[model samples]
Structure formats: structure tokens, C-alpha cells
Target chain A: MRDAFHDELNALNDRLMQMTNLVRSAISRATTALLDADLQLAESVISQDAEVNRLYAEIETSIYELMATQQPVAVDLRTAITALRMGADLERMGDLAEHVAKIARMRHPVSAIPVEVRDTIVEMGQIAERLVTKTGSCIATRDVDLAKELEDDDDAMDRLHRRLFRVLLSKDWPHGIEPAVDITLIGRYYERYADHAVRVARDVVYLVTGSREFDDSAS
Target chain B: MRDAFHDELNALNDRLMQMTNLVRSAISRATTALLDADLQLAESVISQDAEVNRLYAEIETSIYELMATQQPVAVDLRTAITALRMGADLERMGDLAEHVAKIARMRHPVSAIPVEVRDTIVEMGQIAERLVTKTGSCIATRDVDLAKELEDDDDAMDRLHRRLFRVLLSKDWPHGIEPAVDITLIGRYYERYADHAVRVARDVVYLVTGSREFDDSAS
Candidate 1:
């Protein structure tokens, strides 16, 4: 039974890795669409959201079944619970990507953002992608050190986020209020993505450390 | 042990209800300050945030201890887990109120938003406060039906949010970018508050139904 549970756990992690990779691609494609005003990629992200949502449901059911049937205790319990929380985080990350894609579609033929804003958006995408990648890797290896590094990465994202806002508020901003709104919402989406990534990392840490070492303080 | 666990659970719920009330009042005061340009109220909300954070930590530690000691299963496990998640949702709600309050301070002698925008903000506040109140009641009584009603209230908040954005985007808007940024962030804070309320309601539904229902489809 324990060996079977181990296999089930590995299967769960595999599903999570797949979801993380898909969400990363969605984020990348969504950013590309936003930066280039590519309607096709934007539409693709939106259409792909259903698959992400379905995966979320499937993972939720599987995790619950594992818990119920295995009655897992100790490390096994932690692993199952972490998987459940990570699934939610990944799903929300997907939702954030979908949101960015929707914004991309809204921009359509004419870009609402200035070139500077586009640059910030792309950097935000890269940072978010890195966080998501780290989260997936940490889950695969149960690397607490990697999880801690992801926590630090979020601090840098926070600094960049603040800088992005400062640029928005600068006196020389071009294209007026619409760009400001776009930039603000875009910053929020990236910040949220980073947040969920941090959450996944923290769950990894908790699974290994057996301590609630980080919480709101990490944010 | 089970009886003691229930007592501790009740105490935790009581603390949570108190926090919810504080957050609800904070949101109300913050919104009032926003509309009335009352800087003092915003300042008070910001200062009071530490208390909320402290209570959150205390509740979290209590939940952790319970889980570590009791090794609770099934309904007891769900209840404790739900309490911890509820504390988190409430803490974020407090933080949102703090953000709104900060916005109030940012616009000290608050920026003169148009009457239409002010009305929408006021309405948004009312909805947020009601959701807080109803969700708190749901927690205290374990009333799933009332929790469902709060979910409906969240839908109302969404509608108001969309309407506010539409008004902001309307061609005749006279305001430039600053008010636009403020409105955009304020909308996000309210939207997040609604999201948390919906989360609390979903947890209640799960407790009542003992079923894993995903928010993606229901919402």
C-alpha cells in the first residue's frame, strides 16, 4: 500500500509538472500576444484555458481520493495536501495568464500600450515565468533551498513592480489614461502570478520542514 | 480530545468573527474616507492593520498546533483546515481595506473624483461590507444557505465593478490619468474582497456538502 501510495504521489507530481509547463507556455504566449498585439496567440490562450481548468478539477479529485483511500499520515499527508494547494495555485496562475490574454485581445490591431510599457510587460512575463519554472522544479525534487530562492525572486519582482508603477506615474508618460489602466492591470496580474508561485514554493518548504516557517511575512 | 478540539475550534471561530468585523468596518471607513476625502479614517485603518495581522498569526499558530496534536480526520480535519484558510482570507480582506485606506492617504484632500465614480465606489463599499458581514455570520453559524447568498452578493459586486470600468472608459470622461489609476486600483481591491468572500462561502459549502466543488465552474 505504501509503495502504491508512492506511485500515486509521483503521478500527482507529474500532473502538476505538466500543468506548470502548460501555464508557463500560456504566460509566454500571452505575453507575446500582448507585446506584438497578436490576435491569434491571444485567442489561443483563451481557448486553452478550458483545458487548464479541467486539469485543475481532475487533480483536485485525485488528491482527495488519495487522502481518503490512503489515510496518509506524516510526510505522506503533507505531500498530498501540498499537491492540492499547488493545484489551486497553478490554476490561478493559469487564470492570470488568461487575463493577460484577454487584455491582449482587447488591444487587438492597435496597441494600447506604449513601447516602454510593452518592455515592462515583457520583463514581468519573464520574471513570472521564472518563478513558475522554479516552483515546478522544486515540486519535482522537494528542494527546500530552491523554494527559498524562489521566495527571494519574489522580492525582486516586488521591486520591479514598484518601479513599473513609478514609471506609470512619471510626468512624461505618453498615450494617457488607457495605457495607465492597462499597465496597472498588467502589473497586478504579474504580481498575482508571482504570488501563487511563492505559495507553491512555500508549500514545498512546509512539506519538507514540517513547520509553518513562512506565511504572510513572505509576501 | 474531540470535545476540547471543538471548544478550541469555537474559540478560533470567535476570533475570526471579530477580525471579520474589524475588516468590514475598515472597508466601510476606507470607502467613506475615499468619498468624503477623510484622511484621518484612512490613517486609522492603516494603523489598525497590525492588529489584524497579529490576530491572523495567532489563529494560524493555533490551527497548526491543533493539527499537529490531534491529527484530526475527516470533518474535524476539514473544519480546522477551513479555519486556517478563513483566517487567511480575512487577513487579506483587512489588507485590502488597508490598501483602500492608503489610497485615501495618497489622495489626501482626496482627488476630486466625479460624482458618478463616487457613487459607484460608495456602492462597492456597501456591497463589500455586506459580504463581510454575511460571511462572518456564515462562519459563526455554519450557515451554508447564507453563505450561498453572500456568493450572490459577490456577483452584484462584479456587476458594479464592470459598470465602474465602463464609465471610466466612456469617451466623455474628463479626468486625466491619476484618477484613472486610483479608480483602477480601487476596483481591484474591491474585486479581491469579493473573491475572498466567495472563497469563504465555498468553504462553507464544502463543509456542509462534504464535497469538493471547484469555484471555476460555479462562479
Candidate 2:
């Protein structure tokens, strides 16, 4: 029974890893769709979100089932609970990616991001991709250090997000209200994507340390 | 032992109710702060969010403890898990309200919503308040019907959100990028707040029905 419980836990971890990969690909593809105005890629990313949601639901149900049957205590209990929270964060990250893709698809032939701020958006996307990749590793290996490092990536994403805001607020910004709204919302999507990644990492920290300190800081 | 478990469950429900009330007030105050440019109210809302977070943590810890010790099954188990998810959604709703308040504080001495879109924002805020109020009742009574009605409020919010965009994109948009961005984000904050309420209501639906259909629809 103990071995079976451990196997279920391992399966849960694998499912979470799969979710992280799906979210990573969604954000990456969504960014490409946004920058290149590729409706096909955008649609693909949007539709693929169902898969991420499915994985999230499956992992969440499994966690609950594990808890109900195994009645894990101490670290094992913490692991199951934290896995549920991390699944939620990852699912939200995927939703953010889908939001970006929807914006890209809505704009169709025209890029959602104006050319002047495109580079910053690209940089934010890169940071988000890197953060999720590291977060996936952190979850799989329970690497507290790697989880801690995601904060730095999140900081980089924040700086890029601020840069996008500065450009929009600049007197020289000529894109007017439509593109400005698009850029602001799109920037927010990327910013929130990184935030969720950081949140997942923080959940990993909590699972390891059993401390609410990291979770508190993320808020 | 069963009585003790019931007492604990009641305490969990009370904490959730308290959280709902706190989040409701936060959104109300945040909306006022944004519309009136009241920095004091915005600061009050922002600072009060800590209480909401504390309640969230307390409720979450209690739920986990209940599950671990009680080993609740069937309806009881579903209730416990659903409470956890509902607490999370309510906490996020509080955070969204805080985000709105922060925007209000950041834009102090100036209204965030331009005059053209001010009424629409006001309407959105009202819809959010109503939905949350119903959501609170739904949580307390397990009123699946009331929970289902939140979707209508969400639809109303979506329409208002779309209206804000139309105003921003209109040729008559007098305000430049700065105010436009502010209005856009503020609209989103309210929209997301309502979405979280609907999510909480949906959790209640799932707890009662043991079905994932509504949950899938919301996502």
C-alpha cells in the first residue's frame, strides 16, 4: 500500500510536469502568433488549452483521491495539498496564454503588439518561457533553489512589463487608443503568465519548507 | 468525534463567509476609490486586503487539517475540497480588488475612468457587487440556483467590458493612451472579480451535483 501511494504521488508529479510543458508551449506559441500575426498558430494555441485544463483537472482529482484513500500525513499530506494549488496556478498560466492567443487571433493579419513595443513583448515572452521551463524542473525535482531562482526571471519580466507601460505612456506613442489597449492587455497577459509561474515555484518552496513565507512574498 | 468534525466544518464555513464579506467590501471600496479619486479609501482597501489573506490562509489550513484528520468521504470529502477551492477563488477576488485599489492609489488625485466610460465602469462595479452578494448567499445556503445566476451577471460584465473597449476604440476617444490604459485595466479588474465570483459559485454547484459540466463551461 505504501508503494502504491508513492506510485500515485509519482504519477501526480508526472502529470504536473506535463502541464508545465503544455503551458510553456502555449505561451511560446501564443507569443509567436502575436508577433507574426499567425492566425493558424493562435488558433492552435487556443484549442490546445483544453488539454492543459484536462491535465489540471486530472491532477487535481488525483490529489484529492490520494488524500482520501492514503490519508497521508506530514510531508506527504503537504505534498498532495501543494500539488493541488500548483495545478491551479499552472492552469491559470495556460489560460493567460490562451488569452494572448485569442488576442492574436482577433487581430488576425495585424499584430496585436505595435512594432515600437514588439521587442519588449518578445523579451517578456522569452522571460516567461524561461521561468516556466525552470518551474517545471523545480516541480519535478523538488529543487528549492531552482524555484527560488524563478523570482529573478519574474523580476526581469516585470521590468520588461514596465518598459512596455513607459512606451505607451510616452508622449511619442503614436499608436492611439486601440493599439494601446491591445498592447496593455497583451502585456498584462505575459506579466500574469510569469506571475503564475512564480506562484507555482513558490508552492514548491512551501511544499519543501512547510513555510508560508514564500507564498506571502509572492502576494 | 462526528460532532467535533461538524464543529470544525462549521468553523470553516464561518471563515469562508467572513472572507466573502471582506472581499465584497474591498471591491466596493476599490470602485469608489477609483471613481472618486479618493486615495484614502484606496489605501484603506489595499491595507485591509491583508485581513482577507489571513482569513484565506486560516480557512485553507483548517480545511487541510479537517481532511487529514477526519478522513471524510463522499459528500463530506467533496464539501471539504470544494471549500478549499472556494476559499482560493474568494482570496483571488480580494486580490483583484486590491489591484483595483492599487491602481486607484497610483493614479491618486485623478480619476482612473475617463468621463466617457465612467458610467459603464460604475455599472460593472454594481454587477460585481450583486454577483458577489449572491455568491455569498450561495455559499452559505448551497443555493445552486443562485450560483447559476452569477453567470448572467458575468455576461452583463462581459458586455460592459466590451462596451468599454468600444468607447476606447471610438473616434471620439478624447483621452490619450494613459487614461485609456487605466480604464482598460480597471475594467478588466472588475471583469475578473466577477469571474472569480462565478467560479466560486460553480464550485458550489460541483459540490452539490458531483458533476464537472458547469465547471467546464465556466472555464
DockQ: which candidate is best?
Answer: 2
* Tens digits of lDDT, candidate 2, A1-219: 788999998999999999999999999999999999999999999999999988987997788788778777778887887888889999999999999999999998988888899899889989999999999999888899999899889889889989999999999998788889988899888888888899899888888888867655453
Q: State in Å the error of residue B184, model 2.
A: 0.9
Clash totals, every prediction: 0, 0
lDDT of 1 by residue, B1-219 (tens): 988999998898889888988898899998888888898888999999889899998997787677667767777877877777778788888988998888888888944356768888888999999999888888888887887787688889999999888888888878877788889989989988888877877787787788655454422
| TM accuracy, model 2 | 0.97
The lDDT of each candidate is 0.83, 0.88
What is the Cα-based lDDT of residue A45 in candidate 1? Answer: 96
Candidate 1 lDDT, A1-219, residue by residue in tens: 999999998888898998999899999998888888899999999999888888888887787667666667767876776787788789888999999889889989866557766676777888888999999899889898898898778987898788888888878877777778888898888898899889988888888887765666533
Best by TM-score: 2
